[model samples]
Target: MKLFLTCPKGLELLLEEELHQLGVEDTKQTVAGVQCHGDLEDAYRICLWSRLANRVLMPVYQGDAETTEDLYDAVQQVSWLDHIRSEGTLLIDFTGQTRAINNTHFGALKVKDAIVDQIRDLTGARPSVDKVAPDLRINVRMHRGKVTVAIDLSGDSLHRRAYRLQAGQAPMKENLAAAVLLRSGWPARIADFDLLLDPMCGSGTLLIEAAMMAADIAPGLQRKRYGFSRWTGHQKGIWDELVAEANGRKAKGLSQLEISLVGRDEDKSVLRSARQNAERAGVAEFIDFAACRVEDLEREQLPEGVGLLVTNPPYGERLGETQQLMFLYRHLGDKLKEQFAGWTAAIFTSNPDLCKVMGMRADKQYKLFNGALESRLFVYPISERRPEQTVREEEDVVPLSDGAQMFANRLLKNRKQLAKWVKNEQIECYRLYDADMPEYSVAIDMYGDEVHVQEYAAPKKIDPVKTFSRLQEIMTAIPVALEIPANKVILKQRKKQQGSNQYEKQSETHRFKEVNEYGCRLLVNLHDYLDTGLFLDHRPIRYRIQQEAAGKDVLNLFSYTGTASVHAAKGGAKSTTSIDMSATYLNWAKRNLDLNGFSQGAHQQIQEDCLKWLRMQRTPAFDLIFMDPPTFSNSKRMEGVLDVQRDHVDMVDAAMRLLRKEGVLYFSNNYRRFKIDHDALSDYVVEDITFSTLDPDFKRNNRIHSCFKITHKA
Candidate 1:
């Protein structure tokens, strides 16, 4: 049978590769989804082992559809009685394009009507529609006037997996959380590492997923029911055989495994939930759950080798307070710096500002989406700083601008060959665009006929002669690799004024331009922000959006220069809206959209706070919404700081208000300490969409961003 595997936007390739390694045949990519041919046993095996797929679907039939009658006729022609009995309960899910069948519920109603009509004609009775606990679930997808119907082989989303017996405030889905651990290189055979720890282990999802992986336990083993079980074609013997094989493969020598796994949370209820989840996954014996604040966590007493610590902390979005969380993160960083010597630590958070409080530099970083929150996973390899390192006061460094023009002239002359090379080779994008101090140290972008550049001034510690020489060497080497002549490169130094305040000088000196690359136009300006023009970490997520975006309306909230929007529009979003408070960013977004030929009436650029705009919008506005808010932002225009950990409930509520009933909202944030206010959001159905967004490039950093897909409860 042919099967479809659905995952979050970025992980299709990963899922495809996993399927191939498992020996599943005919694996291929389809938009944001994947397709493979497998028997009932293969389907079950995928459910148990696939770390990337969200659910497994078995296609039953496909036919043409031009109207509601055509849809009903096509659905009715399927042998419904063969798959679903009259005594069972049924549910229908609809997706994709259909003119008369646009609304999911209306489409579901038509399918249900057809199924009942067909069943009644044959059996004299029909199954009832049960949205929850349906014995058999059918999915109908229409693409370009063609309809394909499938049976949802997995009952609940495969992410449920039955391992989680209890949940904390904002628990991650088992599959997604597991994918993070796998992507981060956790649970591997590493030597000389202390242990794997989640400092803010709400519900222990991360810890449980880690423990399961460490034990080689199939995630789906705990699930008791599947949609296929209710279908007539399900082979009990095959399923039993698969389960036995899975059990036989389960790790028996866990004690022989080198690493220990630990999770700590401040909430007592959350600790209880974590323990309960661990027990459900049958790994309670292997995982240690403790109730403690991040500040109180100490390095375990182990042998000489250092351990690895990875954590997802609060983003202060939903909790209504950020100052305390910021302070906690700062203290957490201080503790790591002072205590966890020789240990490698990865911090997952959507909040860059909070990350700065740690006052430590990460050795590696990756972009990930936690739910719909855009976040970063910063890996700080902690060990003793080189003893030769010494603190120097700002007063110690010589000023390069004290003698400016002579230095600038010399730098320009040295880079003359490099500039010509840049133009000759058409080096579209390169770092260190300019290094004219007294003026700026800028990065240059060569986009065919356009030259986009960002300017930066020299750092206080660097000497003019040394800085210019370094810039010349870098510029020369980069263009040569691109086969460009040095005369084509344009080098410019940023100007600095005497007695200017540090903040003013830094803010004024930096500038950047947008460029188009790989079918998407991006605004790649690294000078003004810590991140340059592109986020290589979210490379997968953008790929997913582009792949799945054809003919869909995309809503991008907190759309920083609309990178995702650019990808989505280029991927074929019928319309796109980029919302943010900064006009500067909106203008940049417009430039990117224009570069992609999507900056016209079909795309809307809104310069407003997303929260405010969401509150003002009505329902059924967009098909897909991508929201990645800052961990903490206190704009002068807003009444308070926008905190993801604290404001998530409200943010979700607002975003959902604009979503079409069947539409999905991809909400993400970088707040490592973020906890979902599940109680506050009991009405909407939420799934942790993080795992499907994990890209291989982000293996070093876990919890890049916590993402969730939410829709109104059916």
Candidate 2:
């Protein structure tokens, strides 16, 4: 029989290579899968052991299907009784589209119609559709009017190995983690690397996959269900023998293999999840979990033999993340250089440019994908003999692209343009250049001694290499033009953060710098968070809060780092309350209050969801409230998803309830599509203060955020 093993794009060649190791010959690589000639047992073997395959498919028919009628006719050509039972349940997963069938769902319906009709005609009954847990899964692919229908041998995608009971933020799929291990040639060279370590392991997906592979455990052994089990053509005898063989090998492999594994993460909650996942994978005894920061990785001991270090480090997808994560990358490189003399390290990340900061030249790199975004697996041999690039050379006067030259000229122009305004307004920090030039897509801001450059995520059509080259030129240009050292120039990429991602920590830097905004001395962290302690665009807003805060009981909700709370405390508020879910930021808030020399007698910081805290409030209503919630949040701690645009009404009302009758509720959000929800807040008089909330620097981009002053109608 002919079979195809599907996988993520760019891993087709890797999957084919894995099949070759499994003794399946003549495997041909396709776009996102591998085509091979294999019998039932060979197909089952691939399903059981092929770590990279998303699904194992057995094609039963191939023909043209241009129309609905044509698809039905072609699907009817297959002998239904020989594959699935008429009494059994099955489902169709249709892919691709034709002129007649413009969507997957409609095409799926047509295919289902054909199968049900055919089965009914032959056996006087039809198989029912059970999508949740189908007995037999059928895959139909339509490409350029041609369709190939295959019976899915693996019921669910082979990626679901049933070991990962829980996952950390941005967890890599189990199969992708397995592919990373396989791509490193770890299985074939298991004896070479006795110790596998993941320093930034969140939930230990990589370490668990590595451990399972080292133990020679079959990928599908933990899975209790298979598509072929409920099929009429199932071969129980062959599958039973394969299962027993896999079990015997696993039992023996565990005792014989002396390889050890260790995973570490700074977050204790995250380490707990990794431990639970490892235990579920049944390799808990072989691995150890610890809570440690990347900078402190030197204390961990490396085994006597060759060590393999694999990590899925943070590839800062947003503007602030890149700058903060650069420290992490640099630390990783430093630790590897100081220790692990004879080790192989594989770092998988979507942004390869960030990986360069490690100062370690990648000896081997394979193109792969975490999802839709193209990624790379960079393999480095940690040794004194290995040649690596010096990060200092970033300023070595390389040829600048027209884009880079334009970027530098714009920075100079913006600085010249904003200098007079800065002097007149006494403004220390503001947005300098915000993707003003199309090609050089980045926002350059000066925070006293530091120049923060945020690269806007480029379109897919743009070449990433040219983009980074242009960025490196800008990174070099900023210091020379501004008379600052290269070390003071911070860089990051601006990408829209989604879900509860912004609350998650990017680096364990724990570093903070104090800077002046207007007349207030506020603390800002260029590293460790996507947003610094202060929002530069909201400088005027904080000033407004300060002016209105005197002789009032002030409240700051979602008060990250308590920058606004500090402003309120400094403004002589009779009482101030700061509410936030993150303990880290709350602690920073306390420190910010201390730095400003504010008394703690009436200043309070409550750690919790602002919404929940507001609900518990009744007496001692606040005279002023600054409520700036996240644009969207789905934190596990959150009761439900928070879409600022959708839930702004309820949020505004809740904060209003905590405000005195004559008090003002300053409700604001960075969500671009946010509106004031006039109908929901009919009881309050709403005034749009967004325009008045800007200084000269933010006049170019007033829509970056929207603010409203809401007051109860008297």
Candidate 3:
């Protein structure tokens, strides 16, 4: 008999191979499934042993199904009396529709009518529809002009191993977990290795599947029911023999099981769920569960033997939150090297970009899907020791061309010019160069010991090769001129940003440097984002806040990392409120506040759109408010697009409504063409403090930003 076995889309080939292992040859692979030739015994074995298939179907009839009547006639040719009794319950699963059969519900109803009529006419008894658990579940398919009706032998999807009654936030299906283990070569490597581990194992899906595979236990052993249990052609004698053989093998396999299995997770609640799932799977005695974080995992925690370490870590659904998980991935990578030596590891994640900073090179990768989300399983062979850095100082030092030397000379001149001011003011971060040479169009900034380079996008008229050559020259000149290690130099592109593009991340390296400004310690990520957390050009504005914010209620709008709020808190402000739409940045702001020993109720960090939050306020509570909105924002999270030039008057008016009678409002933006509507706001006083806010480094480019102070006439 011909059989159709269904599985996930990417597992068709694996399912075919699994069928071959069960002594069923002449198999053909199709999209998301396979077709094979097998007898009743072979089909029963597949239902019991095949871990990748979702359903095992036995085709009973084939005919044309151009219309609903055609479908009804096609289903009637299946010999309903030989499959189900006249008084039994039945279900019809219809898939794919032809031109005449446009609706699946109508098609299923016609098929049901045919089966009920045939049974009643032949045996004077009618069958009833049962969706919950049918005695015979018939599957109908309608192609271009043909149909193939089959009986579903597996009552439920094979992925439903009945082991996971509870799961973590996101759980991997049982069949997918089995596929991951197979692709990771667990069966082939089990003899050489003596252990298996999953550091971030949630609900123990992967662990239980591995145990079943190693012990030769049938995945459907714990299932209480099957589609063939009540069918007339079940062949009770054959099924009973297969069950006895399977039980004997299972008893032998479990007695000889020698490998140690361990599962760990940081969340204690999820660990409890995992233990319960393992117990339900009947493999609890073979596995060990613990509540431990990946960061604290040590070499002593494992047994003396080396084995395979597999885990499924949390992959963020939101792109912005992915940047926040960089450190977590890095920590997992660090522990892989520090704890497990000479062991193989398989790490699965939906976001491969976050794996770039894991510090381990993947030896092999397989594309898999966790439900609708596409993911990858990266396999690495852990070495005896962590790999050494390939970069060396001698290799980076090279001769600079004349053009490169000219750019280097200008950099030295700027550093000499600002050295005295930097020393006297105790500055830790400042701009070193800003498009000083037209040929080398890049801005270089110094953040303590590291350097950040932002190359201006070249015009379309320039040659592509020439543009790349100039960038290479700049990279070589910076380290030599500044006497810094080549690895400390991070480069990024600078272009005109729209909407929230300026706030998006550029890389996966969560390298943050701490800098001091006005006696306030702030954290700045120089590599991950387009803009560092602290704006160096706004040095004077932050210093002014520190001087006059004593005993004042402060509010910081469009607070990217809350650097200004930290300044206010350091100056003894009564309370400070920081608002921003990006939760990624708001969390960064909270960490900055905590680093400065200001983690108290006086400092409140809010995640919301600045404009919407301001309009919702009815009380005049703040004494000082800083409003620095984007030049033009069309972020989907906001109600509407924001044009700083067109909406400044209304934004200021909203802020003024929230301000006390004698309070002040400061507005700023980077739109060079921005013009304040002085006439629209005749009721208040607006002072253009653009020049006073520019520090010495940004003096060359006076139009970098615009600042103004607005207050009520007093």
Candidate 1 vs 3: which has more TM-score? 3
Tens-digit lDDT track for model 3 on 1-714? 999998987899899989988999989999889999989999898888889999999999987779777877888887899999999999989898888888988888998999999999998999999999999988888888989899999877878888889999889889999999998888778997888999899899999999988988888887877888888899989988888888888888889888999998888889899999989887889999998878778768678788999888888774334433555677688777766778899989988876776889999999888887889999998887524422332365557998788888889999999999899999889999999888888999999989888878778697634665676678778888998987788777777888988788876678788889979999999888988888888888888887878999999999999999999999989999999999999999998999999966999999998999988998999999998999999999999999999999999999999889998888889899989989998889999999999988899989989999999898
Highest-lDDT candidate? 3
Whole-model Cα lDDT of every candidate shown, in order = 0.71, 0.83, 0.87
Cα-based TM-score, every candidate: 0.53, 0.65, 0.69
Candidate 3: stretches off by over 4 Å:
79-92, 102-136, 167-171, 197-203, 229-241, 262-273, 288-301, 305-539, 546-624, 630-646, 656-663, 670-687, 694-705, 711-714
> Per-residue error at 30 for model 2, in Å?
1.9
Q: Cα deviation of 427 in candidate 3 (Å)?
A: 6.0
Question: Where does the lowest 10-residue lDDT sum fall in candidate 2?
Answer: 385-394
Ranking by lDDT: 3, 2, 1
The runs of at least 3 residues in candidate 2 whose Cα sits more than 4 Å from the true structure, single-residue gaps closed, are 299-305, 385-714
Tens digits of per-residue lDDT, candidate 1, 1-714, equal 899998765456667877997789698898657999987778888977876778788887888896899999999778887887887889998887566767877888888999998888888987898887887889898889899999898878878878777786556666556556655667653555557778899888887777777767777888888878777777888888888877876656354555678788888877887788788778888777878877577765423456777777877673212433555677788788777777888787777667876779988776656667767778887877554432322246423332343443444554464566445634444332334343434555444433333335456586633554444444444344334654444443333322111112122334555554556657665334334546444555676778878888999998877888988888889999999887867887888888777757999899887788888888677888888887777677665677678788888888888888778788777666677777898899888867777543233244657777788888
Clashes of each: 75, 3, 0
